[model samples]
Target: MEEAALLIDPEEIAALYRELCQFPSLSSACIGPEVTTQYGGKYCNIYTEWSQRDLERAENVKFCRQYLIFHDSQSIVFSSPSGNCTEIKGELLSRDSPSGAQKAVLRKITNSKGEEKQFLEVWEKSRKVKSIELTALEKHGQVYEDDQFGCLAWSHSETHLLYVAEKKRPKAESFFKPKAPELSNEEELTKAERRDKAVKGEQFVFYEDWGETLVSKSVPVLCVLDIESNNVSVLEGVPDHISPGQAFWTPGDTGVVFTGWWHEPFRLGLRHCTQRRSALFYVDLTGGRCELLTGDTKAIWSPRLSPDQCRIVYLENQASGPHQQCSRLCMYDWYTKLTSVIVDVVPRQSQGEFTGIYSTTLPERCWAADSQRVVLDTAQRSRQELIVIDTLSGSVCSLTKGCPLGSWAILTVDRDLLVARFSTPNCPPKLMVAFLPPAGKETEINWVCLEEASPIQGITWDVRTFQPPPEQINPQYEGLDFEAILLRPTQIPQTGKIPLVVTPHGGPHSVFTTSWTLYPAVLCRMGFAVLLVNYRGSLGFGQDCVDCLPGNVGSQDVKDVQVCVQNVLEEDPLNPQRVALLGGSHGGFLSCHLIGQYPETYKACVVRNPVVNIASMVGSTDIPDWCLTEAGLEYDQAALPDPAQWTKMLLHSPMQYVDKVQAPVLLMIGEDDRRVPPKQGLEYYHALKARGVPARMLWYPGNNHALSGVEAESDGFMNIALWLIKHLK
Candidate 1:
């Protein structure tokens, strides 16, 4: 096993990363061609890959915005407006601003070496599209990722453009600083030497979800552009504390409505910032001033003005409790200065066939043309469902009933028609369209499947949901439970008992549903039965069930998983000894605990970015509330860093059973992970080594908590496959 581990090529990990990236990813329908690409009468829309932007930048310095049809899915054949078959490729542009004159840039990229063709393109509609580089201050200290044209917007007149860009922070001399070497010195420093030469303290500059690549790269700042004059200026007056995005033009286009964070410094870096405080604020285009719309209170996001421009609707959570709380549907009246709760509570179960309000925050533009109703995706019984909420009558209606079992998310919506990205347990992501029927005609709306993003074949799935007996559930969580999903090869193994891979999801708050996922698919292909334990504390089971994990972490949640696993093994021809475990973050916390608490039960374990010592992590992590609340301690912005809290945290931490772990483990960590710092993994790794337990660890540089840099995630998955083969197989 050591020899084989040594032989694993570092490049193969990158190859797998690219291979995974090539897998069909279905993004929301920001915009799609209602007519075929052949009808390119005026707006010749064309989409290209962003990674390939360097190619055109290096080779073709100048290009014209001529073509109109482009997208990121498959090279699809569709009828053009001219009645001819046309191919649409790259990602579809946002239809929200299609009425204006914009500048579009197109670039082509080679995806997965040769497996797929992808192009990165942006639309530039103005007559003369120009580019102006920024000054040191104009860059405004913001890193703008390809978050679907983030921080980029056009005014109502299409004359002024608004965007947020990254600006470099001035370097500061540190107190524990080392003297800088002369640049003209005898020898040049290697990259590693220069990196090591930089002096830094342990204090984090900002609390970011993913700590490394972005935080270090740049800060976010709002910018304005004059299209005809070819000039740019950084907007001022808005406080630097907030990181705002998803800007929308107000009624008169005189101001902007956007979402930004408002929290203490300790709450900065958490991935789930919504758990703290988020609000919709309006920014004056002229004065550059900003003001909070939702007041200084509960979390609110994704604010949208009614089509009539008189009313507004946004997602609101009234209570500031668990990170995974339910969203309340809020409505605002511009004239009356009154806000109403259109839907205050998520019905524990469907009222009549009407599932509860869509749980997650909506992306931009989910409103109907009449602006009377809104649509969003919801989680009910582990199924991704689509529903419409009528603002005036507070009526809830179901849109998807007979479609294949899967998940559906909004891509683009206009008037009553919506294009959604659909994924079933059986196949890859596909573009689907649905219409909102007036009031009573819910069943008349049909969800039609259209072009696939990237058609992935050979891989198939057999997934089912299991309800662990209520009697078998942890007594404390009895009657308050969620189901576990079991997936395997459609054809049962004929020989030895098939190995079982038990996966616990991160976000003890997050749920594992009957959706298509790559990890489980990979394991199933490797000839293992995979069971995803939603257990308690997961979503879709209602807020009461989700709130159960606070003080019960490491105990109740672990028991739920163990019982779920035992129930599955008894019902199937699965091996009881060769059980393999996989998880990340909270899931990893459970994995470490599972291996130690049940030392003789499992064969191997794989953990990525795990939390081993909550006491230590409470200080280093961005979300201190996670450690506090999960330990059953009532979290306060000020009353923490206490010894009483440490006792509870240590009790819940996996570190308590560090000496009993028997299963050989593989640890994958992101060097820049802020969520569960890399030290947590290192501590666990060294403990395993000291105990003489077989262990291996890998660290990906510059990756954040997710370790999702294409090559890094790929490397982690490939090594997991190799490691599992040596142990579980």
Candidate 2:
């Protein structure tokens, strides 16, 4: 057994991850001014990609390339077949721009020592130095969208910049808090205040999201920088209750429109609670004050103002409910201040399953060139579709239709056309340009490929779909049918079934789209068939399906996943005896629940940032309401849960099945995670250890619930691959 484990070549697994990471994963993109004839292409200048020769080098030492433009609507590979970033020539504006002809520059560098360093150099058109700067749009702690890279914008003229920065560090909270006078001498404090400060040492800080994400601990200071004048200003008068994000400049540069969370800063626990109250606000730059645009605390996201500033359209819930509220496209008239529901997108109309806006984060460039329409990314039948909704008529139309089994997003919007990046279940992201139809007609969007096939290409990705039987419950909310996407080798010999790895996405409210995923793809390359089930309680299936898992997260979700896995094992070429379970977040919670309940079924289990103990998590997690809502108890943010509630929560948690786990389990956790709390995974690890179940654990320091940080995520991904490969093989 030991020798077999040694032969599992971790380098190969790491290479696969590194190879995929090398592709510039384009998310938020902007359309450039002109389609230049240079390189016979116009450029979309800035993007994020793997930094170095491999994943480690890219994570530790990476070169930030300014722009990687599409060369004449043709797909091109930027790296060699063996996965090396190939240096290519471009007409990019650089400091040494003396030559009228484009020049070749050093394109790649290595960081063998693993030193923490970054290089930033700038020069004006004349190539001269200027001593000028702002307080830096940086923060003392992690920025709000560090993980998903959220809410970054450039003005219409691209001069002034607005971004979320950690303005200042907050003071620690004490059991016996002190109240300061309105007017006090800064030089001299009262004796009692001085004594209290001297005796107290900072302990635990209360957070509502991941660790150190408290708005009070390090508030998101809205900073605006004037690049031309070198003047920086921070917007003031924002109520202490609100934590602002997803901000963008309004038309004519009058003010900034942002999604603001109005919560008691003293009781900062709802920042990550999606069901919590949130609204839109306008920060008057000239007056230095923030005005509430939407007075009601409705869950709102991605407020895209029209080019004419006539209407501000955003995604909001039709009903005020916890996580599973039906989502709708709302347009607020700027002149009359009247709000109207443009479309009722949820409640599963049966005709459209993926019409609900992906809602978590809307693309920055959602508005059309005409501004009479808005383009959005929606989940339909487990696949991502980029649809444009007409503001006047409230009609929705798909931008494209090929491979509805994959994923798609509009990165840049130019006039009526869209520059989108998408991928299939087997393909990587390919940038293309598609257009919306004229006023009342529905036209199929023909995508013009911006770049060629991916750098690491040529592997055939075989993908298919399977549906599990409806739940054996009442027709109302139970047994709403769901689907799972299967991926494996394209060419399989007629023989025993391939090893199966069952995966469920996190966000009991989130669904697994047919997008290309690194983990599942790599596992498939490792000769295993992967199953991604968009089970009960997942989005895209509508509100009824989404609402199904909340009060029955453990039971309902576990059963759906089991049914899907059994279906795959029974019909497909999947090895039932070698089946394994993989998931993270709530997905991890379900993984643990599955292993404990059906202990003998799974041969191995791997979970990252899982919730093992809800009783313990309820006390420390940022979203305490999650514990209550998922456990079948109503959440009252103001009231403490009773003992009976605690008992029920414990029973609902995976802890109840600790004694029944028979699979060899591998646990991965972020030490600084505040969502589930590191203690949640640690407790389960120790419990399994004490029970003599074969268990191993890995913890990434300073990582939150999304353990996909550069180094931490790469290591965690490789280890998970190793663990699953070792056990399944």
Candidate 3:
């Protein structure tokens, strides 16, 4: 048995965390870039938001700024375009009119007493046109901001604004509360007064909302704001059970087109789950009628209208099984009301072939100037690549085929030009722009970098493919292969062997691309080799690979991770004895499984909000369907699982082998987590403690499953480093 130190230096952990905080990351970039005249030349202005750790606040502070990339008639200038801007408060969503003459901004203001108010402000040129308070007493409830049910769109005619907000409901009050004063004979009661007088004691009524991170978002309704009269009206004709979102003005401003998700069966966690049952809907305001655009499809998202407004292109997925899968790109003709699949799901792909689209959503504005081409980013193996699809011919072309080893994501498409962000595991993100080449000439794209790559001093990385042994491979997924990104330090240790830290991503359905990640880079800089595994169920390899892990979790995933580590150890200068594990959520489940199944392989393990017991988790997790489906069983929320089903779930859980775990474990739990309840980690901690095993647990209040609150993440990472250092030695 390996001996571990009982104490670790807190100052050492703090210093290392502070050093890691120096790397700034790009949080988000605006979709459209504006061309402006500056210094007697043409320049492209891109607004990007960045985040960096603030030790004083114990959280990340975001900075929204503009990047000015210079361009000329003859050539483009490659230089740093980083600049600064002041922060705005209470801003929820904002959009500019198609004519660029006016802007609409939505803000939610709250007083010190916790009272909230929503305001919609319209600005014309440099002057404020009007500001209207959208009060719940007179209008709807809070405006929807979650991606699944949020939109702020301007009509082409610029006469109205369309947005999604919560449907209004009567206020719940206590029946025994104080009564209202008697009205005098001269007093006149308005409609609002009359409605307020009918109070009901329904404060304890239960209403299920879209789970996890979407609090107070039960029902979303389409709202149209008439700028001329400043009157907001909730659109009718849509089914009462449907929640509308991603709305846009239809051609001729006759009505609006949006995605409607069914809430009848029950609302599951929507943040990363794209398999929700939904369809494209068109609401005809003039006729007061609603029409289903793509009734054949089960799930639909991001309905983007072409620049010519003749067709709508969107992504669709299967409505059942895994939370995510390869999506099919489909287009709808506005005139004929016909829908056709442009790219179907790819079940298998050979090496260097086009894997199916794994991106959850497309960029806001992705249409090319020709209106026949659409550009988007998707996962291809271990990296994200940008591709352009010709809507007319259905021909797919990779815009980043011959580029350097990195990930490319489209920020926005401006007519003939495309702005993208490129980054590698060692290099920070750099903004770049390229002109769309003529048809069949995509390989000749000339990319001009707006920001130079900032590479970390001692960090370097490469993707390594691993194959499971023939006997260990699942026959159904024989065509699938997994990958691990090995990030190493340039300066080798004195012993010529590096300690290894195996990191796996949370989403069993998610993939870890060859993109810059802070924690792995920090570990590499601290003389540790970090291996990020993309196991069989990870997205981007094809649909078959994703389908392989449903019934075989804890076994297939666990073996693939072991194979990856063993392969890396054989090919690289890594110390097999001094290995540690780091993961969160499903990844954390794998870590716990690996430590217990192969107790001698790892010396230390750390998990964040890990799923330890699936049987218990099924009752508390926001996505109960995930629990049943992943266990290779059917999901019927109304029915309770029998004894046989509970046994199967437990047999596939990490807690089944808890007694075999020898590695010291550190658990980081978010007290407010809804996806994977904190009790999951607490139960495991107590079990390990009872066994007299070395274990420690950290509890974070006001944090969710991601433990992503700035303070929580920072403090968690520091403790993780300390734990690994103390035990790995």
The alpha-carbon RMSD values of the candidates against the true structure, listed in the order shown, are: 8.5, 7.4, 2.9
Candidate 3, residues 499-549: lDDT per residue as tens digits? 899988777999999988878877887778999999999999999989999
How does each model score on lDDT? 0.65, 0.66, 0.85
lDDT order, best first, reads 3, 2, 1
- Which residue ranges in model 2 land beyond 4 Å of their true spot? 1-18, 35-53, 58-131, 136-160, 169-217, 226-229, 265-273, 285-290, 318-326, 352-354, 454-471
Best by lDDT: 3
How do all models score by TM-score? 0.80, 0.80, 0.94
Query: Per-prediction count of colliding residue pairs?
Result: 44, 9, 0
Q: Encode model 1's per-residue lDDT on 1-729: one tens digit a residue.
A: 111111134455434334444444554444433443465432223221112111212211211111232321222232122232223343222323435345432223345655323222235533434534333222344325444225456676666666655544434446666665566443554544433334355344653432323353334556666667766676665667676665667777788777666533533443454465767777887888887776657777667777677778877764355676666788877667678988775535444344345355675668887788888877765777777788998887767767777777775565566667677554656656655666667667766555555434433444445555655455554556467777765555355476788899998787775666777765665566788888777777666676677888998888878888888789877788779899999999999999988888789999999998889898787667788888888777767566777988988989899899989999999988877889999999999999999999998887888876656755577788788768864
**Best-first order by TM-score:** 3, 2, 1
**Candidate 1 TM-score, true structure as reference:** 0.80
Query: Which wins on lDDT, candidate 1 or candidate 2?
Result: 2
